[model samples]
Target: MLITKGYFYNRESHVNCQALKDAWVTLLSRYHWDWFCTFTFRGEILHPEKASKTFDTLLCKINRALFGR
Candidate 1:
């Protein structure tokens, strides 16, 4: 399924980073969706490398764990 948070993330002020991160982890753990995607618009990233590790690397890890490839 195609899940997106672009609308909700239109502005950084509208987001709670920790809560959003927790939600993503919780939902992903609770559901076995075939595939997914996430995004955010231009904004000041507090920690770019850490954000990548949390999102990009985590997604890749999930995909690998599920698909075994």
Candidate 2:
């Protein structure tokens, strides 16, 4: 069985993307399964372009860790 959870933040909230990335990587590393899973995040980013870059980096890291690319 696979379990998935999502976290959302409002526009006025202050979010540390690096901290979030670290937490997610740690969680993924700790409890990863062979079955495919998806992670969806919904929140307000103060800088969409910057956040996009960060998320892209996060995705690459995740793929490399999970798939050994």
Tell me model 1's lDDT, rounded to 2 decimals: 0.68
- Candidate 2, residues 1-69, lDDT tens digits: the string is 222243335556544566678888898898858886464556854477776787789989989999997
Clashes of 1: 0
lDDT of 1 by residue, 1-69 (tens): 222563235433455566777898998798788967776635766477767766777779989999998
lDDT of 2 at 52: 75
Off by over 4 Å in 1: 1-46
Cα displacement (angstroms), candidate 1, residue 3, comes to 28
Clashing pairs in 1: none
